[model samples]
Target: MKEIRVFNNVPVLEDWMIDKQVEKQIRFLKAVHPQLTDIHWNEGRVELRPLKRDPDMKDYLRSYGAWHFNEKDVAELKKFLQQINGKGVDLYYSAFAFDYSMVVYKKDGTKYEKGKVNGENALFTSVLAADFDGITVEEFRREKQRLLDLDIETIDIFTGHGWQSIILLNHRVTDKEILKKFTELMTAKGFKVDSAIVDAARVLRMPYSFNCKALDKKTKYYDPVSPKIFATTDHSWTERRYHVAEVFERLNSLPDVIKQSDALTDIDVKAISTAPLTNTEKKAVKEKAKREIEEVKQIKVETLKAVYSMLDFERLPEAVQKMLAGSQEGLRNKVMMFLIPFLRNTLGLSIQTIKQIMMLWGERCSSKLDTDFVQTEVDRIYGLGFKGKHGHYTEELRKAYGYLEFDKYTKRNKIIIPNGFFEDMSTMSDGAVRIFLAMKLGESLDGVKNFSKADIQKYAQVSERTMERNIKDLLSKGHVCKRRGNRRKGEGHVYYTNPYFNSVAGFTMLENATVKLMLSDLTDGEIKLYCFLSKIVGDSRAECWTSQKYLANKIGKKGHDSISKMTGSLHEKGFITKKTIEKDGVKHSVYNLNY
Candidate 1:
């Protein structure tokens, strides 16, 4: 007898059963992306490379499916699911978001007719993932527990036949080497991690999407009843995203073994370092070494300058100059104490100069000390052998001694123009030149900031059309470069000016007033002359001496007459004061910049 179940006065039959696969897929997508309600979620761009079963190839799939696709916003991604939900195809999404409107090209440098994605266009990777295949559900759970025991957070998934685990990073890792090393470390840890999914553009099965591999007869897990199975989230470790560096350090710290089981020949397990360093780690180490070397060099330079006979007392700090002028009887000894270090450490004065200055100050004191006492005091202080800014008086101590330290008037706002930069700007449009200067002014202590197009327009004071046209020109000329912005903000592209120009050991500083004159008042030819003079002038002197011919060649002009005329114009405009100076019977033009 056939039995029928009745519920709520309605008979439910076996033939009337309904599959809730669509509803399950909707829930799965929501679970993965709970930030769907957040407006910024859509700004993170992604790519969906839909692949259908290849008729000619038994197990392979080709990206020839006809469908409506979009990757601009997170909301758009939901729409994409509807287009391919029922279609007998496999769906894979980019591992990381990308800059908008990124055109992907083929391996041979030809443009793709439709769409292709890879690491070349990735903005950044938030999660480091590993795919372990041919493992049962039980084994997947065991591996999950193993990672938990080690205090590693992960999001584990079951993709029909195998397991995939993801470790979220606190911040994005833009470097590909770091992501690759992560996957390699997983493999080296004796897990059967898939080596091929290391690329930033690598794709994984979309959550809640049908795993079409079950339908392929060539696959080991092909089933008769259910050809397509859902990829489900087995467990989620949502406590926190681990710091990117700490996660890498932790994984590399684990016991590693040479992987002879991987069929991939490209990865040489023996060549890999036992402890791999991310690009960030390598950069930090390099910067630390560079800073230490620079500090030593600076100390040496300051020490060498003490031998010069000319002492510009006005250039010394006001407090130091006053102390050197001598003090009353009550403050003489205290003044001497501070002056010793001020001369030796701050000014890097030679021992002989320090002694001479000390003796001179003692003689000028109201109640003078004995010459022998002054000499002995100087020797005693010098014997302490302080090095590298030791015994330097702090600002608080300076105040207590009735002296103002580190006066604000000594600081200058400087705009650094890399030497030989004029050559790159010669061919740029006037608007591009203005934009470049604005970018220089916009630089912070960290060098450059990620700026949107709107931010740039505000900084450059240009119209939208002007910005669009000249910025494109700047990019084409390689004077500026574009980088991905913070995906959380959905901001426009960030640009870097003069990316290829290498700032050498020498550079020219344009005063704030000089920059205004170059941008607004001075002609382009006059600006060129001014920039060249600014470069050759000694740091201590406002005037520079050069032949007209030398200036002509540097300014990219063929004739000395052009340089002479430009200099005359600059002088007329009160930007410089010109004079003729004779050295070794060679009359050279000397121009003093009026800043």
Candidate 2:
């Protein structure tokens, strides 16, 4: 006889074999039945069952039930097997213990009864198996080779007396009808598929474990064989197993194994345990959406009042305009904080209206504010009290919105350019007007003041080229004089405001610090409007009673609305406040200085 490798009628599983072979089977088992709560194995037999809750494992095991397998139970299992190696114990494991149940119905609409079966239902998955009884080892090997030739990947396990080969699917198959059809197809292919094993409670020999056979009163233990040679093996198999994507690709390649129609049809709601929403639920959802849309539209319409109140909103500097329009959440929130009070106190709008409008505005932001955050902000504003008479506009609010800050210039150094100087400069480029103002507000106490090109460029918010062009225009127009600095040392040119200009008025009687701080954040149009208001208010009084038409004429703007809007922008920036004063049965706005 060819040398048969047997160890004293006992099969010894080496540590390396357990690591390589037995561990792989355990992994595949876990992958197949990941929801398996409990598994049972005995010294001479193996049984796997899902843990029942009430009785518990300790009670069931005491009643001669198999040992339960948990995450940590694998080590205990290996140790038990090692101790019972020569004691005539054989290991078997339950297969197909999935969460889903497959039921077979009889003609009476009741579950079909079977003999010696725990239940008519079975746990079905992607696993497909075929039994080859009364077949020699050589014949079984040839059958496996034939399946390989046909490009069908499978795992073969020797059951001591017979063989059982299984087809590992790309994914788990849970549909009962599909499982039934698959089994029928396998039977048609001349493979011995056990129809009785379709039930939930079924067991198969645990691969890599001993298979004890008793013949003529003599016992012999045979080692189960499980070799890694399959294209569609479970990824939990070896160290370098197939990935889910590869498994899907392999599954797609097998048209006969899984028909496209069957695969697509099986993806219905019944397959995923989800039901379609009822018509009543859908109608409720639609109504909610419609209500939300109407609310947003109403809020947007109301907010237009606050937007229109910023009369010189369009006349604000490009940077200020961008800060208002751009999606900077913090800056936008700060703007809202100042605007809410302005609308309530200055414009006299109600809190409820402001809340709705601000909520919608927050929603329109680039990074939309959450409803809770918007609500919190509205609550904060409410807590501050109405204070409709007292103003909430502050330097902090202006600075928070990226308003430029001006260096404090002393009152003695104030240069009072005539109202006509602004009128004449307004006709030039905005940059030119800004540069002239920058030169006028320098550190010098009188007449000629020294200002670097960098200082003028920064104050004017212009590029180097634009600053140069504006400076040239100012010099050509006799508004200022420029003395070039040392070019080699990278020094800037010095600029001096022309004191002898015909339109030049005496030094401004108002506080220089107030004028500089107010002018720092205003546009050319705003500056012109502020100058007209200053002339009207005079140096002694803080308020000026005037009509929009009068301000419009002074600013050279034809539209009274334009004048009102410019005044609003001035009001918004804390330059001036406008209150309606009725005289001779006619309402006129009295502009007051808030500086």
Candidate 3:
């Protein structure tokens, strides 16, 4: 068995060496206990008793021969150490009360329960000893390497009989729960942790102190195994100490221990039962949350409604309109299947209301929709909710459904047309009327306004063939003039409308409110009738005399009854009044304008 030498009695230190060691010890103590004012040294036993910096501290220091040491005491301490050499006395120092607490093992090597210190908010430095009965030197070396791998800065000390690893923590870890969890983790990671050494009252052997346990009477030094500078925080201080802030940070980052079996571990059932919410209060909170959701939903719905309303459905191609109307049940189902969610989510329309509208639209289609199939699809869609897949009508669908035209319903950068334009074009086809408006509305009223044939076709939703025909008719009737541009340069035909229509005998200037009502609320047929009546009656005349058949021919209606129904609708809307009149034994309906 290897015998351990516990004291360095063979070499007597020179006066300078003894003074240097004493100064170092004092510096260490001062760093750890900066507030201590009373330090007592008696027969190789040092005690650092702290006193309040008051008159009482001065009196106590004088009486007990305790004083804060300075450079003057260094020589005296060196002399004292030389006198005590080989006197069977061992050098010892009182452990200064640090800003931290640590555990120390008793000399008997007995294990005890881990104890707490008073300053829970105090900072700490930890040390692990591999001096147990069976730990080998190789095992200690391996443990040191392991701590290095964990990024823990360690100060290795050869403590005469064994090894000690010191780690300094930078921050305060005041919570006991945190400390317990940290220790548990360290133990799990194969560390030889001294759990009982966590007490604040524990003292540690000072570095460079002489151990008196050697049977050979030779003094063994409690020296640092590693360079002192390497052991300090950031390797910046020249002391046998280290900052293990990184290790503490890693420990803190570990996931909190979760108790799996106890579901009610966190619940304070007694407190909850004592302060339960009233039924009315709970209901109010639920309602408030629901209202907030509904308000957000409403804003989204309004935005979608605006986009849908901007589409000119009436101007779509005939085939596309037929598809939308469900002329083919298969095609209609495919289209409506995609559009239903948009109607529900964007317009906030009820499923029942959407079904009703689809059913009505189907009647106008070439083939009516299947009610059973429609009902089933709507129910299925409502169950799926909105996932953004079918929440919008694509551009392809818009073109196929005859919504590609730019009309009053379409959003525009700007639209400027004379009030008389509509009245003058009342007798034309809807396509022609829209084309004429498109020509005039491109810019502000100016001299010789120009419009390309392609632009007119796009805005009016008319075919090239139809556009040519409309331009020809307008030119022949003296409604507009056309100028051809160079075809090689991709220039198009330029057309200009007459400042005023010659055929319109008089003009009726309508108010902004009236024009808005006509554009947004009135049907095409109603608008045509109102424009015709306004022209014939002029602002001067209140009434006009004409038969339903003649009125039907003027407004392009095929049936006299259709004209009578339009008249009645206009009358009900307060736009016109109707009465019978006779001239030259011929009876006629006289219509009078209300505005």
Winning candidate number (lDDT): 1
**In terms of TM-score, how similar is model 3 to the real structure?**
0.27
User: Clashes in model 1: which pairs?
Assistant: none
Model 3: how far residue 578 lies from native, Å = 99
The C-alpha RMSD in Å for every predicted model, in order, reads 31.9, 28.9, 33.7
Candidate-wise lDDT, in order:
0.56, 0.48, 0.45
For candidate 1, what's the RMSD?
A: 31.9
Error of 2 at 235 (Å): 78
Model 2: runs farther than 4 Å from truth? 1-410, 423-426, 445-448, 465-473, 483-494, 502-507
Deviation of model 2 at 492, angstroms: 7.6
Cα error, residue 112 of model 2, in Å, equals: 96
Clashing pairs in 2: 122-200, 311-565, 312-565, 416-508
lDDT of 2 at 113: 34
Model 1: per-residue lDDT, tens digit, 201-304?
A: 67777544456665556777555564544444333323234556556555556666765344222343233222243454355446534432121111222432
* TM-score per model over all chains: 0.35, 0.29, 0.27
lDDT for model 1? 0.56
Please tell me which model should have the higher TM-score, number 2 or number 3: 2
Q: Sort every candidate by TM-score, greatest first.
A: 1, 2, 3
Residue by residue across 1-595, what tens digits does model 3's lDDT show? 1223333332456767667667765655443332222344311122332222111122222101112465555555555556543332233223222222234344588533222223222233223222212256556655654654343434444444445554542222223233343444555555665454443333444444443334222324222232111111111111222223345445334343533232212132112111122353355346534432121111233432333242233332333334444322113434565556644443334454456545555554433433543454567666667755243444434444444332222112223334455444535664455455445444422223677777667545567898887666567656678778879997877877776643444334432223334545556567667766665655354457767887777767788899888888887775677776777998777787654
lDDT of 1 at 208: 45
Alpha-carbon runs more than 4 Å astray in model 3:
1-12, 27-69, 72-84, 87-134, 171-185, 194-196, 215-246, 251-595
